[model samples]
Structure formats: structure tokens, C-alpha cells
Target: MAQDKIVFVYITFPNSEEAQKVGRILLEKRLCGCVNLFTNINSMYWWEGKIEVSQEAVLIVKTRESLYPEVEKEVLKNHSYSCPCIAKIEVSEVTPCFYRWLLQETGVEI
Candidate 1:
């Protein structure tokens, strides 16, 4: 059993196709164990001093803190949205089974 904390990352994309790009790359590269894409999400934010709204898909990426910098760089470089949103939050705890599976999927060691 592993006692590792997971890092939760959030990223938004304009559409499903774009979101899939990130998902595929992350999974293929073993950067993330999973990415939950939420479609039909309405996002509203202020950009360049103006309010903007769009239909976006939210990506919930499951990874580790050590991978954040690279994960961010890859997404920012490939994402179509300007000034894309990327945020991270630390996981305080997780089930040992899930933690081990995450480690296995990402090829990370505890």
C-alpha cells in the first residue's frame, strides 16, 4: 500500500476535441492517471478588463505534484485557448487501493 498524496489539476478547453488532445497526451506520456472531462460547462471570466463567456469543457487531471510543471508546459503549449486556466490542489489523503492504482497507471513509485 502506498501513502502518497494525489495532485488534482484543472484545465479548460474550448471543446471536446481539444480536451481529448490533452487527455491523450497526458495518458500516453504517463503524466496523469486520469482526466475527467466535463462537457457543457459555461465559463465566465474577466480577460483584458472585459467579461468573457464561453462553452468550455473542464478537465480534472489526476497526477502528482512532481509532474505539474511539465504538465502545465505541455498543455499551455498545445491548448488553443488564450491564457488557458491551469490550477492545482493537493490531496491530503487517499485510499491505498486508489493510490496504488494511480501510481501504477502513471508509472510513479511511492
Candidate 2:
């Protein structure tokens, strides 16, 4: 895979406020070009040997694959959850214009 390929960092927060907080931090730091937040997402998963369900906010960060480590580190530092869900999804493709825009916004050489 290309090192500079765009990727989406998917994260879940306790609430929209928390999501927005971290999202802004990522943007301000230029770790990500943009973030899309979805609130009131119903999540069900296993936690501590039991099933848990909750309403959470999703923060999808658009950034370069090479910046995943920094983005994950920042998210871990600012996130409230002890074990926050931070997953990186490599984008298969994107529009040329948008890709260039993302690279420019993230300070990547286009």
C-alpha cells in the first residue's frame, strides 16, 4: 500500500461533545484533514465478559495512512474512554480533487 494513501480513522466517543473536542484537536494539530461526527449511534458490544449497549458518537477522521500513529496517539491522550475504539480503514479510492484537497489540508505534499 502507498504510504501517503488516505485513510479514515474511526473512533467512538461517549457523546457528541467529546467527539467534537477530539475532532477539533485533530484538526488543529493537522493530524487529519477533516472529521465527520455522527451522534446518537447505537452500539452493542462485549465488555468485561458481558454485553453492553449504549448511545455513542462516531468520529471519522480523514487523514493520510502515514499519520495513523500520531492520530491514534492524540486520540488516546484526549479520549475519555479507558479503551476507546480507534480503527484505521484504508480508503481504496477517492476523487482526484478531494484527494488532493485532503492532502493539502493535512500538510501532505500533493
Candidate 3:
């Protein structure tokens, strides 16, 4: 419980291809510990004063809160949307072993 430094970043992409690209970039750059992509989800949102709906892929990125800004920049740089959906959820609870693994993967020593 109380995983203060960990965060789950939620991002929606137009397709699995883009999601994979961005996910790999994040992993390679050590910006995130891991990324899980969920594909073929229907998303509806408002944009430019109109409603839009599409099949989208969502990426749940696990990382430290300290790296959030860089992660956002990386996603924005590779994203195709004029306005992409990027949200971060604080990780309130995590198993100690898994949390340590996350930190180690992201190049943080604990």
C-alpha cells in the first residue's frame, strides 16, 4: 500500500500500431517501467465543438511520477492526434516486490 512514486499513465491512440510505437519508445528510453496496450475499444469524445467516435487502443503505462513530464513529451511527440487523451492515475497500492521490479526496470535503485 501507498505507492507514492508510481503512477499509471493512461493514453488513447487511434490504433495499435501507434500505441506499440510509442510504448516501445518509452520502454527503450526508460521513461516507463512497462506498458500494457488494450486494443479495439470504442471511444467517444468531444472535439472542435463536435462529438466523435472511433475504435481506439489504450495504453496503460507504469512509471514514476517524477518521469511524468518526459513521458508526456515523448507521447506527444509521437502521437497522431491534434488533441490526445493522456491521463495519469496515482498508484495507491502495489506489492513491494513488483514495485521494486518496476523501479529496477526504470533504472532506479532502491
Q: Point to the candidate with the largest TM-score.
A: 2
Clash list (residue pairs), candidate 2: none
lDDT (tens digit, per residue) of candidate 3 on 1-110? 44448899999999999999999999999998889999999998886899988899999999989889999999999999977989999988888888899888888767
Model 2 steric clash total: 0
Q: Report residue 1 deviation for candidate 2 (angstroms).
A: 12
Tell me each candidate's RMSD, in Å, in order: 2.6, 1.9, 2.6
For model 1, residues 15-62, the per-residue Cα lDDT tens digits are 988999988998998989899999999989887999999899989999
Clashes of each: 0, 0, 0
lDDT of 1: 0.87
Please give the distance, in angstroms, between residue 71's alpha carbon in candidate 1 and its true position after superposition: 0.8
Q: In candidate 1, which residue ranges exceed 4 Å CA deviation?
A: 1-4, 47-50
Instruction: Assess the local accuracy of residue 59 in candidate 2 as a C-alpha lDDT between 0 and 100.
Output: 93
lDDT of each: 0.87, 0.92, 0.92
Pairs with steric clashes in candidate 3: none
Worst 10 residues of 2 by lDDT: 1-10
